[model samples]
Target: MQFRRTVIALLTLATFGTPATAEGEKAGAFDYYVLALSWSPNWCLREGDARGAPECAEGAARGWGLHGLWPQNERGWPSFCRTNARSPSRSDTAAETDIYGSSGLAWHQWKKHGTCSGLSSAAYYDLAREAYSAVTRPVVFRALDQDIRLPAGVVEEAFLKSNPDLDPDMITVTCKANQIQEVRICLTKDLIPRRCGTDVIRDCTADRALFTPLR
Candidate 1:
């Protein structure tokens, strides 16, 4: 009877042990990583308006932040855009002038092709000296968080297959703490794009500028 009891106990343990070991192996099979990026509000100002102005003005003004995780890239830099301002002027005026003046500084940093001609001649040329002074100002980029695990042979095949626009090299993995919360992907750059020959960045849907890579 004692021998029979011992054999039964050993069998029960083996049945559970096999599955538990397999579960551990599955969990440990792949490495995981998280990446994070943040941008200041200065980075959100319209690039066209901020042109020729010192980069520091945007940093000094109301700042904004953007965060995300992406796969590692060997040669790509983080990108951001400036915010757009609106005016009711038919041609040009003071309100439009102010908007252009502020946005040009931002454009200079993010859009290599930005110009400040949309403002009236007086306003456009008046701020040139100030813009030139801030021209050499450095814009800051920071990686607030990172949790990269060493490479494993296995990858998250499903995730890679679903997101094609995202560069595989810049793929980011995110985990939520609460089951009810949803993950969010945010575009931190200004939603508006720069005009062809204007310093103003408009917020109207019909006039929105599409983001292009800075040259």
Candidate 2:
């Protein structure tokens, strides 16, 4: 009876995978990072306006805002991993609102992807800010004075042209409901440009994705 119970326990562990730490997977165990930049105007049009997101206010003129810096694997990603890192305080999250558009997003990013980085909350936020500054967002997008519909590849091409170090494989443009959403760039743990994993390389093929001008 004891032998049968042990065998069953082993099988359960094998099937469910071992929990190395607390109630989640071990932290700091990822291959690379994905920097996500959201087009603020488009997002406002999609869902922010309804939610009354302050970043969507008229004349905000927000272009590409930091969405998150996500820890990713070669084929998958980690989230909400167990870590001993301290959570960001309200002030810590507030400091990132300029880049993230809201303290709520900053908080969420730290809770989800940031926890998986294994870095202390402060270090993770600092790295996220650093990564955002490293990318050269295309000035052309901000020059738009009106809403327009263009091929999604145009957005990708602009990014490639603006950041010579970024190759086609290192970045991807995502769209939703025929609207341009965000530009996701893959980088090394040290924040250098790198090819994205296959799972992160999915690009939008919309021939006429709506792009809204900065407010």
Candidate 3:
């Protein structure tokens, strides 16, 4: 009898908990979206320079570039979901190069995040473009003439000041290798500002992180 009771308890625990999303699960099963904006100058200074990436060319003058529009859940996110949607054509990916830095990134974003959106490649790209346009990236950062180190919170504050609609809870700044990495904002599927999930609201507490100036 004890053995049967233990088996039943285990079944109950497995059925009721919030599980991390499995790879290649059903599409469009997420709760919200995270729009990641990468600081291009910082990327150039970090990984891009090592790879001799064209985006890091001396005169590019890149700023905040669209990273990806990731689908998120209240607890755990989905990725590389199974979908019947066709992959994006080369031209479709190329159309996004102005904001995404390369056609390859756009294609990769579609395969990873866009597949889980339940939208066709065309619709997903359109939505991604629309979300990128809605956010107001701070202009003051562009005026930076030289590298500086500052608290990561200052970057978050500047974003809040520029975008009054975004509350502190809706956005976060992340750091990598003591350099400012990406600014992530949570939004509803319809592209309205929303509070991020607990897992998504991790703010970088670094007192000083390198900020590279644009070319």
Index of the highest-TM-score prediction: 3
Q: Write the per-residue lDDT of candidate 3 for residues 90-204, one digit (tens) a residue.
A: 9999999989998999999999999999999999999999999999999999999999999999999999999999999999999999999999999999999999998789899
Backbone clashes in candidate 3 total 0
**Tens-digit lDDT string for candidate 2 (88-151):** 9999999999999999999999988999999999999999999999889999999999989999
Give the worst 10-residue stretch by lDDT in candidate 1: 194-203
CA error at residue 120 for candidate 2, angstroms: 0.7
Question: Weakest 10 consecutive residues, lDDT, candidate 3?
Answer: 14-23
Runs with alpha carbons beyond 4 Å of true place in candidate 2: 1-23
Per-candidate Cα lDDT values, in order, are 0.26, 0.92, 0.93
Best first by TM-score, ranked: 3, 2, 1
Clashing pairs in 3: none
Q: How big is the positional error of residue 204 in model 2, measured in Å on the Cα after superposition?
A: 0.4
What TM-score would you give candidate 1 relative to the actual structure?
0.16
| Per-residue lDDT over 88-148 for candidate 1, one digit per residue giving the tens place of the 0 to 100 score | 2333333322323344332332131111122333333333323322222122212213222
